[model samples]
Target: MRLLTVLYDRGAAQLIRAWRRSLHFRVVSVTLVSSTLLVVTFSWLLASQITAAQVGSRLTEAQKQLEQGRSYLEPQFRDRGDAADPGLNGFLRYATALLVPADPTAYYVLLEPTNKDFLKAVKPQSPQIEDTRAAQDAVPADLRQTIEHSRKSAYQYVRADPDGRGERPFIVVGTTVNSAMGQYSLFYLYPLDEQVDSASSVRTTVFVAGLALVLLLALLSALITHLVVGPVRIAARTAQRLSAGLLDQRMEVRGEDDLAALATSFNQMAANLQRQINRLEEMSRLQRRFTSDVSHELRTPLTTVRMAADMLFANREDFDPLAARSAELLQAELDRFEDLLTDLLEISRYDAGFAVLDTEAVDLVPIVNRVVERLRPLADRANVELRTVVPDEPVIAEVDPRRIERVLRNLVGNAVEHGEARPVVVTLADGDGAAAVTVRDHGIGLNTGEDKLVFNRFWRADPSRARQTGGTGLGLSISLEDARLHGGWLEAWGAPQLGAQFRLTVPLRAGDRLLSSPLPLVPEDAEPRLGPIPPDEPSRGVRHAS
Candidate 1:
């Protein structure tokens, strides 16, 4: 039963797939089925009408012949006068010989009363019919009863199989004949072989014609479908070509029809899209040029300002306290400014497509550990606990160590800044062909819908809040670009007050596609709980562990 069910389901699926793939097949199949049904229904109606007409005509003819036989035999009986009583046997035999058709296509039977008590012990005689018993039995009992009970002429259709011959249709007509002798039942059987043959011929003709018509309709339907679907197929191909960067491809317009108009519109759309793309390309080229030129122009002045600020900050103890503090502030601001300019330069290099990776097989565990150790001082000041979960085995991958270190630094720093004095977990794991790192901060967390925006340049979860570390806001964006360079993935997930998790997944070898991340974006220990933090909560911090 299971195997049968599987076979049935497989068959059904194949049929459905076939039905969807070919419009021509669908159309042809439907047309053939509908035409066959119509042809069969019409043939059945025509055959029924023909059979009824043939039977009606044969019944009428049989009734007339029966009446004629009765008339001829009755007259003979009447002419015998008083001699009819004793001469009934002679009359019956004579009538039988006279009335039975010599053509062999018809037969007759004459039945007379067996008892002759009214003739003073004279035995009534009946004419012998060849195969009389078989013929009598062939007639339906209901039809015989109908004739026996009524003097009115009656007829019925029956199949006659004489002498073991195959059954053939026949019409049986019966009536009572009155004479000086007792009444007799006269029956004439007429063979309908000719009518049956004609009907068979009609059926064969109808079947052949219906089949031919169905075939013709199928051919016509296929031709029509081809004419309509040809243009659609061409349009689909041309569209595919356009999508594949063949901007100059266009459909040929042949006539002033809807299909031609559609082709015209499609070509126009392609032309318009090509123009817009060209314009956008020109604009992007100009923008990148302007950014590169501006960054280069500002570098000279920025270097001079940085030198002056450093000199003042170094000699600040010689000045008043307020002057010293101002000089320190100036140095810090200049440092932040320099960092922002450096980030902008890096972004410009990425936009100009000049960034290149110096890849090497490096263990990511030390890199992650070094980044966390470097940020331990900052984490302590922020009162945020930092935890590391690195596998003992080296997680080796082909990556640019500098870029990977920068990415990790940015992610860990961002988590510490937003940790809200809560614990932050940095995890690293290795898979079969990939390695991943996750930085999860159980901080004030992120608001709904801000997870993806966190990767955008300069995007902040809370713009009103100032950064303790003075982030340049290009960190995550540059990190994403760096991951993409290695054909890796950088993804973020967050919930309200449940902290945010940033995941970086890379292939074991540079340029290889990473199918999955070894580490989950969401921490396993995090639960869905909501409450307000108490003001008296102590600031907790943890030291880094390798």
Candidate 2:
């Protein structure tokens, strides 16, 4: 039973899904249901009216025949006066030939009334009826009571064995006649076999016609809906292919109609998109080339300036205080410029898809510690405390040590820079074929939509805020690329005044997929301050940006 219920539920779900998804199916189904209801309703009304008319005609005919029989007998009783007439038993034998004659589809009953005063000619006689006892019993008592003390005729329908056979339909009419011999009670019965047969045939015809009409309506609706839905389905498929990078894909316009206009519009939209995409592609290609070329071109001059700046700094004590300050400032700016050049070149390599991984299994514990130690001075200078939460056992994963170290340095450095004189927590945990690192800082956190923009090239959350820490603005972007290279995730979560958490999740085996992170992207305390996390971008390894 449970299995049957499951199968039924599954079938219902599939039907519902199809109904929701297919316009043609829905239109045809609605037509079929509505037409079936209408056909059934009208057919029933028509069949019932026809049956009532047939029955009414039959009743009228029976009433006329009853009147004829009454007219024929009333004069006979009047002419046979009280002194001349025999008893009702003799009268029955006399009138039996004319009134109670054999009938194939009817029965007759001649019953004596309770008041014998009416039968003045002789003693009362027992009731006599033709055919089986079932026919006599077929007369409803209420119908007989209506005729007992009245001259008017009354009629009713009943079902019984009229011919010593099984029960069949019948029409029983009761009446009374007045004459000089006295009033006599009489009844006539008629079977409705012909009327029943006619009504049944009409019902069968209506059913068959209704069924055909319903089927025809369904087919017409299906064909009509298809003419509209077919082109829409083709347009949908074409849109899908266009989105999948087939920019050349376009719908074929067949005629000068609304559907053809839709196809024309779709093709025009595709053409416009393809043109814009090609222009953007060309621009991006040039931009990458310019950056790579400029970075390489500046390296020579930068090296020559570096040597001179170093010598001038070494001999700065020999000069005055102003000269030494100039030398120090020059050296610092040069270092910053060199760092920017290096970052730009690295970005160019990533853009060119030339960056390759040099992966190996390495302990992440030492790497985390190493990054913490390197950034300790910077954190201390900013009046921020650096903290680390790591397991005693070494965290191991297959990854490039150099790239991972660079990512850790970038994350730790950013945390300290933005810690706002508060503690920076760097946590490491490993589990379930994956490892994760979370760097959290209590500071003026990101605003709405900043998390997604955080990893965008050269994006700044608060550009007006003095960046004394000298970020090149490509740190997070590079880190995201590195994570992606390892088939891992670098997700960010932040809320205004609730601080921020950056989670790095990597699979234990390089090139293997990462299902989940060992740590959450939002800190426990910050969850209430945030709304729902943004949706994951599966195309990239990064999941949600909260």
- Could you list the CA RMSD of all candidates, in the order they appear? 7.3, 4.8
For residues 404-426, write the lDDT of model 2, one tens digit per residue: 99998999888888889999999
lDDT of 1 by residue, 408-493 (tens): 99999999999999988899999969998989998877776677588888999998987899999999888888888778878887
TM-score of each: 0.82, 0.87
Whole-structure CA lDDT of model 1: 0.79
What stretches of model 1 exceed 4 Å from their correct place?
1-18, 63-84, 96-104, 113-134, 145-157, 163-165, 173-186, 321-326, 352-354, 527-546
Model 2 lowest lDDT segment of ten: 117-126
